[model samples]
Target chain A: MSDFLFKRMTLIGIGLLGSSIALAARQKGLVEHIAIHTRSQATLARAEELSLGDSYHKDVADSVKDADLVIVCTPVGACEAVAKAIAPYLAEGAIVTDVGSVKASIIRQMQPYLPKTVHFIPGHPIAGTEQSGPDSGFAELFINRWCILTPPEGTDAAAVDKLAQFWTVLGSNVETMDANHHDHVLAITSHLPHLIAYNIVGTASDLEMVTNSEVIKYSAGGFRDSTRLAASDPTMWRDVFLHNKEATLEMLGRFTEDLTALQRAIRWGDGDTLYELFSRTRSIRRSIIDAGQEVDASDFGRHIVEGGETRAEQLKSDDHKDTGS
Target chain B: MSDFLFKRMTLIGIGLLGSSIALAARQKGLVEHIAIHTRSQATLARAEELSLGDSYHKDVADSVKDADLVIVCTPVGACEAVAKAIAPYLAEGAIVTDVGSVKASIIRQMQPYLPKTVHFIPGHPIAGTEQSGPDSGFAELFINRWCILTPPEGTDAAAVDKLAQFWTVLGSNVETMDANHHDHVLAITSHLPHLIAYNIVGTASDLEMVTNSEVIKYSAGGFRDSTRLAASDPTMWRDVFLHNKEATLEMLGRFTEDLTALQRAIRWGDGDTLYELFSRTRSIRRSIIDAGQEVDASDFGRHIVEGGETRAEQLKSDDHKDTGS
Candidate 1:
């Protein structure tokens, strides 16, 4: 009879993910009430200022007391402590989930503390911008993005479906997979890319021959792309690499090995190898565009967004005018 | 009394840069007449269809005949052949320049064949999208972008000034530097970032553990940023790496060294080192935005372009509405 998925939803951390979930859930009327709790009192105060929740609590236990759904939105490293703090307070039959990048480690960190009365499903919404904090979140951040849920074996089907429906209404395409597979997949798709981006930005800044001003001024030439990822939250990314160590290192190793081969090709003037690899990689982006994961516009559509017209749009208009000519 | 920068301007290749120069020059009325030439007749025909130039030539020498300015816009590898082809036909006292990524190599490849009667100034505009070819250009591509000109010393200062004025009128801030210095600056800013992007995309696609579809579907995490750069023209990138071997290799070495250290930090669970580097790199992107090299909007303003409202704009509107509430 009730349209609400949960009578009360408790968000344990009020960072980008937590605040976004708050804004999205409230905007969609998916929950009757949101009880917010954060380790930092300042963040809690900020959440209240933004009206991100119906009730704000400095005590984690107080926040989860009557919640039928509890979401931990913290750095992967903080999962254990959050689970330990909120475990005794979570209502019977409540659904417990997280929005961490790594799934297996999250399960390992929180599983021991969580009571068997609640259905524990770990989820990672594969969505974010480089910016972080409560002020940086929005209701539409998850629109058309993928939210991957990794529930342990024998979890209640109804609970999982309810969570999936909740995310669906929040404007995400949800996929359920094994915890380990989610980690492995994300290690390549997200973690490795962030690592490489941060690494390259660090290298560019430390260069003595090229001044930092030069690097920043001419960043439009490919380097600025990496800077977006490199500008991600240090604390969150640090926890990601540390928690997802095995898979991150595995993908990173492959990346470095491929990079070494590319270096050799550049050194030996092997245009064929460079051309072959470069050509092959171009199609992957096209596939990403076709798959609806990336915008098809050139330069991520920055020019269109800034200038009000892309070259493709201009060409289309030009063709129309040429018909009369 | 005429306002034209040149009576006739010849473009030696009709790709992204060449076609863009033609469009921008024509739109700005910088030149009286434009001559376009390319090795591929198909591309030449495309340029003609687009009305990119007043004249189209299948023969490179014919394109340069009676031209007061010649811009070779082919891949750096073809600079030598282009120089040799246009040398005899180039008008006396003409300004010969190139839009190559690598300056020193462009000079080496082009200066020998260019006659003393011409002023050879090598220029690189730090502006482009991933798209290529005649259709992928627009008149506004050079606006607010930096164009570096590396004119050899002891050349006619007036000629260099004339060329600088041309770029200035084309909506570029022109800076003059030595060819070697130009190579070093671009090596870090453009070449290295591209190589890393191409390398990582290759690594992601070749992984046996992760399917290509998974990478494509979930690329919004971070990998999609790299794909934009990886989707660039292979022939042009190959020529860039091959032409700027020394500086590219040097930057690659530094990047690898830094990456290895970051890897060690991750491997050893050294969160401080990771945190420090990640936090420091965040400021560089901000500086780039401040310097007008990158869009200040989150996610490169993709959401604003697509949805017509960014989160920041939404927050501002929300604040105004909350004043009375």
Candidate 2:
């Protein structure tokens, strides 16, 4: 009897998520063979260099041929085209899934094109760093992180469990929810936060009174935290906002309303109101830390890295990484 | 002949910044004696227990008597009262400074009460974590950080240089700028970011469609980053918004305007606009990292800590910290 979850597993894109899944699946020995595919030859070559899969395919259909599992790891906007291209080649009883931030739209875009013979489970591993591309992948990226699966209603239960088991082996805590509800939950938790980070960084850059240098110099005060999220992959975030329009806008509306009220309190010098809101928001951070969703260290443990090395030493190390003229 | 910068140094509040200053100054051997005071006897006792200072005083006036350096580390809202209490006792030629977030307001609040015999330099060290209080301070807190000193015009340049040297010895890069200009810079860099963070956390917690538990569970997606800033001291942040009202409101208006445009882009599915804004903001983070204002690691290096231990192991360690029933 085979111990592997599947005899063949194919990845349809080779970016941060795709490469990470490849590394993680192999590290856990979850699949017997892994096939990687991407339209960009540069990425495909890089994945091959990284040895992220057992085989690399430039053609999307060839990548999934006879594969028992196919995971599409493209930007949400490209999911429909990928679904169409790989739909015909997927083996019978194959579990097809895509890792997209917006699940409802992913279902809307990919579900119709997928064959009825295969199980379609839309999943989002709520795990990533600001860095992108093949080199950014690491097997430990999913450890202790949440991977949400939004399998469509009436989907095969056994197939859903199989996919969940795969994510579980990769060290993720799996949860299943209605696709629309997942969209709403993620809108407030993920999309709105990224939108706000990008918007603030733009505002700080464009300010006439405060030069960008000054902003950068003093960013440790608070602004640097926003920059981490703002530095995420532009194409991916753009696709997320476009695909998750309704929930994103709804959450953004609420955020703006709350901000307006806070603005009024600041302008009117309502110290009590400001104090109340600021005080209440603090507990949520404690709750997150308690829930093990956040690092318990202050400033996300940046100080540990910083305190380990002096500024001059850090600069010298960074200079070594820079290209010499 | 002594190597110490000052024969006596006094801190008027024993909070995060105050305690950090005590630790850093002592660590650098810049002060021969450190005197600490706070209105709260509990905090003063706590500081004494921590041995953060050479002497502890219950009376603010007594703390500054014979002190050549007095730094009022109280909230900006309490600066006027602290200045009034300590002015009569501050030694002649003593350089009085503050670590308030709002420079102009600190000047307005404390300058009038200070005697001309002493130099009043309003300073803000642009570094902190979300945690506050006496226990939340470290000697390395000011290392590689920028400390802005806003000394009023015609004040003795010698005294300004002396204070600047003091901060530099404590591992800070000190910059002298006009008080109002410092306020404007910090309004954009620090105050507005905190406001937005506090606002977003508030919005997330109040969502009717999304449970707070769900928000906490999946916060690793992006929302968790904002929580760090929102977790900062409520009393300190309240005073910052109240004291830095004009510049903060101006920056808040700009931020809101920019965010509104981004909101419109999302609503209209303007992918190009979103992509452009997202792509451009990434460079700011890179600049900050280059400037040594932020950690260069991805996700602020949270992964390093997480990858060091499995979730179950981390939970076990955390349980050890909890009080046993």
Clashes of each: 0, 0
Sliding window of 10 residues with minimal summed lDDT for model 1 chain A: A316-325
Q: What TM-score should be assigned to candidate 2?
A: 0.95
- Model 1 DockQ (Cα-based): 0.52
Give chain B TM-scores in order: 0.96, 0.94
> Candidate 2 residues B1-325, lDDT tens each?
8999999999988777898899889989999999998888878888899899999999889999999999988888999999888889889999999999998888888888899999998899998877677766778888889999988899899999999999999889999999889889989889999999999999999989999999999999999999989988889999999998999989988998998898898888788999999889988988898898877667777776555423222221111110100
Worst 10-residue lDDT window for candidate 2 chain A reads A316-325
Which CAPRI quality tier does the interface of model 1 achieve? medium
Writing each residue's lDDT as its tens digit, candidate 2 over A1-325 gives 8889999999988877888899889988899999999888877888899799999998899999999999988888899999999888889999999888999999999989998999999999999878777767778888889999998989999999999999999999999999999999999999999999999999999988889998999998899899989988888899999999999989988888888898889888899999999889988988898888887677787876555523222221111210100
Per-residue lDDT of candidate 1, residues B100-147 (tens digit): 999999988888888898888899999988878888888888988999
Q: What is the TM-score of each candidate against the true structure?
A: 0.96, 0.95
Error of 1 at A129 (Å): 0.3
Candidate 1 residues lying further than 4 Å off, grouped into runs, are: A308-325, B308-325
